[model samples]
Target: MPRRLISSGSTFEREIGYSRAVVDGEWIFVSGTTGFDYGKMTISDDLLEQAEQCFRNIQAALTEAGGNLEDIVRVTYILPDAGDFPKCWPIFRKYLGDVRPAAMMISAGLSDPRMRIEIQVTARRSSGS
Candidate 1:
């Protein structure tokens, strides 16, 4: 199957020249997604809120790619402050408790200081799904 590109209509994707997610056959690669709501381009100041929004954004990309959270096989989390990570565990469990994809977390800086967390995921569509 031909590769397909998905967009969330975020200006950043256009400005940066990258798709929100790319669907190639059964595999989907979702780009690192921040908390800024694509519709309003606004992000909350709270760390938990940002983490929740990150999952929501990722879910949108995965859904557009013909999959859901359950399809995610891997997840990578990037946080500017490593100390804030423990505070986000509840939010993480809320979204991925059952899916439980292989995951990792890294401390890193983001292009925008407003961004506290960014999530990137890899998912595979089940056959006959």
Candidate 2:
């Protein structure tokens, strides 16, 4: 099996020495992604807006890795404030409510204070689906 790496053209990826996502055989592992718009390198202060952008970033990575949000089998969310998590549920549901992948949430600090949410996901591409 060959491994492939995906980059979002974010300077941080080069500075940090990490790809935005990696594909190993049937599995695609997307790194923890914040709300920053890579094209503009800007992040929103609103938690819900950040959550939406997080999903957008995740989706872009998944697509580049030859999969989509529906392919996600597992997901993890990290947030600095637990209270802010609830405010993002609606946005989360809009993306993963039906797919309903195995999910986990953690209260933790992020690299930047403006980032209220970070998301990581693992996806598996079936042989024939």
Best by lDDT: 1
The lDDT for every candidate, in the order shown, is: 0.93, 0.90
Tens-place lDDT digits, model 1, residues 1-129: 999999999999999999999999999999999999999989999989989889999999988889989898999999999999999999989999898999999999999999999999999998745
The residue-level lDDT of candidate 1 at 68 comes to: 89
TM-score of each: 0.97, 0.96
Q: After the best TM-score superposition of candidate 1, give how far the Cα of residue 49 lies from its true spot, in angstroms.
A: 0.8
Show where candidate 2 strays beyond 4 Å. none
The positional error of residue 76 in candidate 1, measured at the CA in angstroms, is 0.4
Cα lDDT tens digits for candidate 2, 12-79: 89999999999999899999999999989998888888888888988899888889888989999999
What does candidate 1 score on TM?
0.97
What RMSD, rounded to one decimal, does every model reach? 0.9, 1.1
Residue 28 miss distance in model 1 (angstroms): 0.6
